[model samples]
Target: MIRVVLAEDQAMVRGAFAQLLDLQPDVTVVATAGDGDEALAAVAEHRPDVLLTDIEMPGRTGLDVAQELQGEQTRVLIITTFARSGYLRRAMDAGVAGYVLKDAPIAELVSALRRVHAGERVVAPELAMAAWDSADPLTPRERELLQEVTTGASNADIAVRLNLAEGTVRNYLSTAMAKLGARNRSEAANTARERGWL
Candidate 1:
């Protein structure tokens, strides 16, 4: 049997996932966690072969949990409601074996588990498209600037937050706008939000 651990903040969602996975003939729900800290603890205690987790939860994020548990012995499958492109990129970078949207049919979950177990990478098709559409080679400074701008900060505010001169902040923003093909700061912010790059 494929031993599985489920981690989700919502009780109903957790229960539904547990029930769905349990119904699989070759799978077993070994444990369940209501938060990231509990998810890590459950993985340590149960040593399940696979962990299915939601991205946002109390204590630690699912990405944090995945970073902690990534290894040969156990695999992580991220299940999230929001299909944020940045989240998907970060999850992939964290070495999660699978990514599934919460609203995906149960069959997708089962197939993801099977694929992860078989040493295959799995991501939602829509998410894959979003990733492809949003792909841009961003410098580290540009990424940081974009993140700061997403918080609704003014140029001076961003400079203060990043401990840079206001002129430097403006320069960074201009460069970022050029790279993203945005006409202004607001447009740049909107583009980043749409791509989930923030």
Candidate 2:
């Protein structure tokens, strides 16, 4: 049997996934975790063949957890609600073997798990297309500034929040806007959000 570890912050979602996997003839849910730290601990304790995790969780992000645990014994599969291109890119960089959307059909998820267990890469095709088409080449600092702007904060407010000078914030915002091809701050925010950049 393919031993699986499930890690999701939402109680209902975690239970549902566990139950679904448990019903599969060739798979078993050996461990379940509600956060990134627990997920890592479970992996160490259970040493499951595959780890299915949500990207955003308390304590440590899924990317961090995956980066830490990815190895010959355990394959990492990231499951997320937000199909952010940046998150996917980071997960891929962390050597995640599979990336599945939370809303994807259970069959797809099962296939993804099986593929990853067999040392194959799995990424949701739709998400892959969207990510490819909407790629925004934002530097880390520019992305951070864009995220701050998404809160509808004034320039001074963002400066204080990010501990950056107002002029520096303006420069970052301008750079982000230019990269996103947006005409104004509001437009930039909207564009970034639409592309899942913020």
Candidate 3:
């Protein structure tokens, strides 16, 4: 049997996935977790063959878990509502076995999981194409600043949060805006978001 651990923040979704996978003849739901930390612990405890997780959760992201477990025994499969190019690119960079949208048919999800368990790469075609079409232009620090800006934080607020000088925050914003060809920080944020770069 293919022992699997499922992790998602939504209780209903987690239970539904577990029930469906458990009914499969060749797949077994060995464990379930509500967040990344719990999922990691469950993996350590069960040492399952596959991990199916959501991209965003309260504790940590599926990307974070995949990066930590890459090259390990358990293969990672990301099942997320987000189909953004940035998320797809990051997942591929982390070497996840599969990345599929939550809106995909149940049959597709099951097939992808089986494929991932068999050591095959599975990615949604549209998301892969989007990843190829768009690229993340911001540096790590610039991305960080943009994330802060998206939260409606001002330069002073961001400076205090990042512990950088207000001038430095403004510079980072300016550089990011220039790179994105945006007229202002809001425009930069919108551009980055549309390209899934944020």
Candidate 4:
């Protein structure tokens, strides 16, 4: 059997995925988790052949779990709502076995899981093209600041959270804006998010 562990924040989605995978003759839903940290625990305990996870979660992201489990036996397949090129790039960089969007056909998702479990890389074609077309432009700190901005944090709040001077925060924001050609902070945040930099 191809044992699988699924991680998604939404309970309904998680349950639906579990039920669907469980119905496959060769695949078994060995465990399910509601967040990244729980997913990690499930992986450790079950040591499943495949990990199907959403990229965004409350405790840890699927990307974070993939990074943590790098080079291990468990293969990771990221399924997320966001199909940003940046996220695809990050998943590939972290050595995830597959990356697919949530809106993809269920058959494709099932096939991706099997392919990934069989030691093949599976990336959505459109996302792959987008990832190839756009390179990550933001510095690590700049991306960090953008992430904070995405959470609706003010410049002062970001400065305090990141332990930077308010002026330094502004400088980073400005640099990111220039690099991304954003008109303002909100625009910068939106741009970064769309690019998956945040």
Candidate 5:
């Protein structure tokens, strides 16, 4: 069987996918996780052939986990609601093998998983053309800061959480705001998120 680790935040979606994959004669969901951190743990423990994940989750994004798992045995296949081309580019840069939308048919998703396991790249046709529209301007640190900014956290609170100095946090946020053409931290965070950079 093609062992898979399924990662999605929504319990219903996770359960449904696990059930569906289990029904496939050639596929088996070896484990399921409700968030990115949990997904990482499951993948580390199971060493599955593929990791099927959603883009946005509670802890790390799928791209983050995929980036962390680069050169490892597990191939990652992203299934996300966000259709932004920036996300596709990021996933490609992170070395994920497949990028498919959540609305895609189940057969396509399964096929994509198989293709990824076979060491083939799989990206939705609609998203493939726009993947090079422009590179994401923010660095990984900027992305993390912007994510914290979206939580409406004060710079001091963010600094405390991220273990960075408050001045450093402010500087990073300011830089990100300028790059995104956002007038403020919240706007910057929202813009980055809208573009699937965060």
Candidate 6:
């Protein structure tokens, strides 16, 4: 049997995936997690063959988990609603075995999981092509500042949370806005998110 660890923030989605995946004769839902941290814990405990997760969730994002698990035995497969090429590119860089949209049919998702387990890369054709169109321009610090900007947090607040100077936060935001060709902080955040940079 193919052991699987399904991770999604939404309880209903997690339960549904668990139930549906469990019904597959060749697959077993070894564990289900509601957040990235829990998903990592589950993977460590179960040593599943696949980690199927959404991009965004509480704690670390799925991309973060994938980055941490690179070179491990378990394969990572992202199942998310975000179709932005930037996210896909980041997933590929993190060594994720597959990237499948949440709207894909369950059968296709299962196929992707199996393929990923078999060491084959899987991604939507268009997305795989688009992922190379333009690389993400912002650095990690810039991305973090922009993410906080989207939350409507002040530079001072973000500074305190990130343990950076308020001036540093402002500078990062400015750099991110310039790189994204955004007119303002809000616009910068929106542009980054639209491009899946944030």
Instruction: Write the residue-wise lDDT of candidate 4 on 1-198 in tens digits.
Output: 999999999999999999988889999999999999999999999999999999989978999999999989999999998879999989988889999999988899999999999899999998999898999899999999988998899999999998999999999999999999999988998998887877
Which segments of model 6 are wrong by more than 4 Å?
156-169
Off by over 4 Å in 4: none
- Model 1 residue 16 distance off true place after TM-score fit, in angstroms: 1.3
lDDT per model vs. reference: 0.87, 0.87, 0.91, 0.93, 0.92, 0.91
Candidate 3 contains a number of clashing pairs equal to: 0
How far is 154's C-alpha from truth in model 4 (Å)? 3.7
In lDDT terms, which candidate is top? 4
List per-candidate RMSD values in Å.
3.1, 3.0, 2.0, 1.6, 2.5, 2.1
Put down candidate 6 lDDT per residue, 1-198, tens digits, no spaces. Answer: 899999999999999989998988999998999999999999999999999999999999999999999999999999999889889988988999999988889999999988998889999776887786878888988988888988899989999999999998888888888888889999999999998887
Model 3: residues >4 Å from true position, as ranges? 151-153, 160-163, 181-183, 190-194
Check candidate 2 and list the clashing pairs. Answer: none
| Model 3: pairs clashing at backbone N, Cα or C within 3 Å | none
Q: What alpha-carbon RMSD in Å does predicted model 5 have with respect to the real structure?
A: 2.5
Query: lDDT tens digits, residues 47-90, model 5?
Result: 99999999889989898899999999999999998889889988
Report the C-alpha lDDT of model 3 over 1-198, residue by residue, as the tens digit: 899999999999999989988888999999999999999999999999999999888868888899899889999999988879998888888889999999998889999999999989999998888888888888989989998989999999999999999999999999999999999999998888766666
| Full-model lDDT, candidate 1 | 0.87
TM-score, per-candidate, Cα-based? 0.77, 0.80, 0.89, 0.92, 0.85, 0.88
Candidate 6 collision pairs: none
lDDT of 3 at 190: 83
lDDT of 1 at 80: 90
Model 2 C-alpha lDDT per residue in residues 57-88, reported as the tens digit of each score: 88887888999975658999999898778677
45-146, model 1: which lDDT tens digit per residue? Answer: 999889999988998989989988767488999999888787788788789999989888888889999999888999999998887776755667877887
Task: Flag clash pairs in model 1.
Answer: none
